[model samples]
Target: MIPLARRAAIGAVLVGSIAAGVLPAGAAQARPLTPATDREVTFTVDGTVTYGTLHLPVHRRGQRMPAVLLLPGSGSTDRNGDQPPALTPHTLAKLADALARDGVASLRFDKYGSGRTGLGAYADKPETIDYPAFVRQADAAYRLLARQPEVDRRAVRLIGHSEGALTALMVAVAAEPRTAGVGLLQPLAERFLDVLARQLHEQLAAAVAAGQMSPEEQRAIGRAVDRAVADLRAHRPIDTSAMPAALAALFQGLGGPSRRYVESIDAVDPASVARRLPPRTPALLTCGTIDPQVPCDTTTPLATALARAHTAGPGRVVLPGVGHDLTDPADPDVLAPAALDALHRFMRCGAPAAR
Candidate 1:
C-alpha cells in the first residue's frame, strides 16, 4: 500500500469556471506568430485528470534549452489561452511565441475538464484541490526537459498566468530540487473575498450611479454580496437557496469550483501566503498596471506581499498599461514595463559566470 505521505504526494497534482464580463475587442492587437511544436502530455493532479500541450521550440541543433511549465487560468479556455477576446484571453500561445524568441521552451496544459482532458467538474473539497501537488507534475516536466538533449536542465522556470500565476508560486516553493524562478500574472494580493467584493462594489456602484441595475436590484445585489462575504468568513455553507431569489440564481451558478473555493479561500490573503512561503527558492513576481481584475492597487499589495516576505533573491515587477496577462498596456493584461525588463535582465544575469 502506498504510504499516506506518498499517496498525498501522488494526489497533489490535481486542480475552474467563471461568469465573465470582458469588453469586446475594438483596439485589440492581432496575435503574432509563436514558434512551437505542439505535443500532448497528460496531467493528473489530486483526484482530477487533465491534459495539456508541450510547446517546444522548433529550432534546436545541439544546444539544450530551458523550459517553462505554464499553468493556465480558469474557465472554458484551451492550452493557448484561446478564448473570446472579450474575456481577456491570455493569448498564451502568443506569450509562448514571445518566449520562444528568447530561446525558452514552454508546456501549456488544459485545465481540468476541457479539451482531451477528463471532466474534473466535481471535487470533494477545495483543500482536496491541492496546488502543491501540481508541483510534482511540474517537477516531472522539468525532468522531462532536462532529459531532452536540447533542454538546459538548470534553467527551467514556471510561468503561470493570472490565477494560474498563484499556482505557479505555490509550485515554485514546493519544487523538489527547487525552481529557478516563476512568472506570476494577475493574482490576489488581498483575500479572495475582499478582491471579489471590491471589484463588485466598483462595477455595481458605477452601474447604480449610472442607473444600470434598478435600485431594488442594486439593493438585492448589495445584500447578496454582504451575505456571501459574511457566510464565507464565518465558514457557513452559503444558503444559495435562501439568497435573494434573483441573487440566489447567481449563487447556484457559482457551484462546484467557485462556491467551494470561496468558502475555503475567503480568509487566505495572497500576500500573507507569500509572506509565509518557504524561502527555499527565488521568484519573479510580475503584474500589470491596468489589470482589470487585479488592478494596480491589488498588484501593489502583491509586491508588498513578496517584499514583506523579504523575498531576498526574488523580485517583483509591475507592468504599465498591460492588463492581467501583461499582453496590453491597457486594462486586463496589464504587465509592468520595468518588470518585463527586470525579467530579461534576471534570466540573463543568472547565466553561468564561469562559463
Candidate 2:
C-alpha cells in the first residue's frame, strides 16, 4: 500500500512511480484476456538459436508502437516468467496484456539453451550464457521489434525483472546507439555473492527460527558462502563453474554453471550506465521491501546513484505488496494495481529521444 511517486523533466518522461511489495491477500477470479494472434518465431545469435512468442494487436501493422522486451529470472521458467508453488504465475503474460490494452506492444521469449535445443541445451550452449551472450540476444530482439513495421523502433523499452534486469541493462548498454529507454523492477544491486549470501543467510535463519535447518547444515552453508565470496573476489566467476567442490553438480546438472548465468552481474551498474546514455534516454528502476525475492533497499541505491550521478533520466520507484512478480496484497489472480499503473505510464508517456 506504500506508493512512491516522483515527477521529473530530467528528460521527457512525464510521471515515474513505485512502491514496495507487501503481504499477499486472497485470490480472485481470473478474467480471460482477449485473444491476440500469437506468433511463434525464432532468431539466431552467434550461431546459436532461440524462440519466442509475439503478442501483437489484431489490427494491421502501420504505426509503430512502443515495445518492451520481457525477460524471466533464473532457472527454467518459460517466457511468461512463471515460477513454482504459491508465488505468482502468469505475471509476464498479465503485464503484456495490460500494456496491449494501453496501445503498447511487447515481445517475450524463452531463455536460450532451452526450448528448441532441448536435452540439456546448456551444456551445448555457447558463452552467451554469459553477459555478452545476453546482450547479443537482446540486440537481436530489438532488431526483431523494430522491424515489425508496427513497432516504433525509437520507442522500444526493456521491462526486465530479477536476473532479467541485469540482462536488460547489458542489452541497453550495448544498445546505447539503439534503445529508447529502460524500465527496471526488482533488479539485484549487490554483487552476485553478496545477494546470494544474504538470501542463503535469510533462508537459513528462517529455517533455524522454524527449527528446520540443523545447526550443522546452517554452518556448512555459511562456510560455503564465505568460500564462494572469497573466490569471486579473486576474480573467479563465483558460480558453479568456479565453486566446483560445492555447488558444481547442482549448477552443471541443472544447465550452465550459475557463474555463467550471472557472469557479469556486476556489469549492471546502473549509475555509470545512466551517465553514458544519451541525455534523451530515460530510465526507471523499482523494487519492493516486502518482496520475498529482491530486497527493496536495492532500488533506492540505484535510484540515488542515477540521480546523484544524474544518470537516471525520468527515473522513479513503485512499492506494492508482492514479490518479484509484483502480485498484489489483495489478489493472487491479479497483479497489484500499481504494476498495471506503472506499465500504463511507461507506455503512454513518451520515451527520451533515442540516444
Candidate 3:
C-alpha cells in the first residue's frame, strides 16, 4: 500500500444542498458534469469499507494517467467536500472534475464521521480519532490510488483542504518514495490550538468592529478562548458553559474525542512537520488573504518552512482576493481564477518553479 493514509446522504439531495445557509431550500440541485467519467469505488481501512468517487479523464490517450488522492476538510463533510446542515458548494467535486479535464484522475472519500463511513469507522469510539489515525487513513488512500490500473504509481499525488491539508502534510512527512507531490490549500499551519485561538480572536474582533459585539464581550470571549486552549494543552477538559454560543461551538468542533484529541493535534507544529519532509519533495503551499480560518499570518510560517526545506515549485502560491471557500472575492459565486490556474498547473507538473 502506498502508505499514507461523510455523512450518509439521504436520497438525492441537490448538489447545491452543500451551500451552508446561503441558497434557498428551493434552489436547484446541480447535475454532475458530463466531461469526465466518474466511478464509485471503495477501499477498506481498519476493517471498515470506505466509500469514494474516482474521477477519470474522458479520453485516455494510451499513456498511464497521473492520480491524486483528495482529502476533504473537517466536520461531517462527505466526499464532495460538503457538510450537511449547511449547503457548501461542491469544492472537492469541482476540483476533481477540473483535474479530470487535465488528464488526471482523483479519488475523494468520505471521512470517518461523515457520509457513508460514518462515525462507526471510529468503532463508536470518538476518542480513537486523532492525528495519527487520520494520517494513516490518508496513507491508505495513497496506496489505493497506487494500485489503480489506470494510474501511474510513481505519479500519485495528494491534495488536501482545510484540516485535510494538515493531514496531507503529516502524510508527506512519512510519504513513500512513490508519493509524488502534495497540494495544501488553506491548511492549519501553526500549532493547532494557537491557530484556533488566533481565529477566535480575529472573529471576535471583527464582530466588535462591526458593532455586532461589545468590546467587553470580545475580551470575555478572548479570555475564554485562551483559557480553553491552555486547558487543552494541559490535557484538561475545557469549560465551555460560560462561553458565548459561537465560542462554545468553535471549541466543541475542535475538541473532538475530548480534550485529548485537541491536545494531540495542538502539539503538532505544522511548520516543524513540513521541515521534516524530504527536501526534494515538491509542494504547493497556498494561502488566501481572506481565509478567516487560516489567515496568512498563521499559515505563512508553514509556507516559509517549506521554502526553507527547498520544497519544489514556486515557494508560496499566494491567492489574492480569495476566501477560505476558494471563491473569488470579487465574485463569490465563482471559483477564484488564480486558484484554478494554480491547481491545473500543480496537478500537471508536481513542481512549477517560481517565475
TM-score of each: 0.72, 0.74, 0.82
- Leading candidate by lDDT: 3
- List all candidate RMSDs to the true structure: 12.9, 11.6, 13.0
Q: Largest TM-score belongs to which candidate?
A: 3
What is the per-residue lDDT of model 3 for residues 1-355, given as tens digits with 9 covering 90 to 100? 2233223334214443566367775332342333567788887877667888888885433345788889888667788888875867678887887787677889999877778887556766788776676677778887877777777777888889888888888877776645678889888777877876776788889999999989998888788889888877876777787698867887776666645556777778888888887776778878888777877777778888888887787556878988787877777666789888888767656633211
Worst 10 residues of 3 by lDDT: 3-12
Q: How many backbone clashes does candidate 3 have?
A: 17
Output the worst ten-in-a-row residue range by lDDT, candidate 1. 12-21
Model 3 / residue 118 / CA error / Å: 0.8
Candidate 2 lDDT by residue in tens digits, 192-265: 55676678678777877899867877777667667666655565544443343535454344233545455465
Candidate 1 ranges beyond 4 A from true positions: 1-36, 46-49, 58-62, 84-90, 120-149, 213-220, 237-247, 255-258, 265-267, 276-282, 312-314, 329-343, 352-355
Q: Work out how many backbone clashes candidate 2 has.
A: 18
Residue by residue across 1-355, what tens digits does model 1's lDDT show?
A: 1123766655543310121234345312232333457767664555456676666775535545677777766555567775555554556776676667666777776664345553463434433443334445445555554455555656667777766666666666656435666666666556666877787767777888997777777667777787777776675766664345655666555544555555555545566667665553455666666667877666676776677665554466666656655554433353244545655754653453210
The candidate, 1 or 3, that scores higher on lDDT is 3
Name the TM-score of candidate 2: 0.74
The best-first sequence of candidates by TM-score reads 3, 2, 1
Cα-based lDDT for every prediction: 0.60, 0.63, 0.76
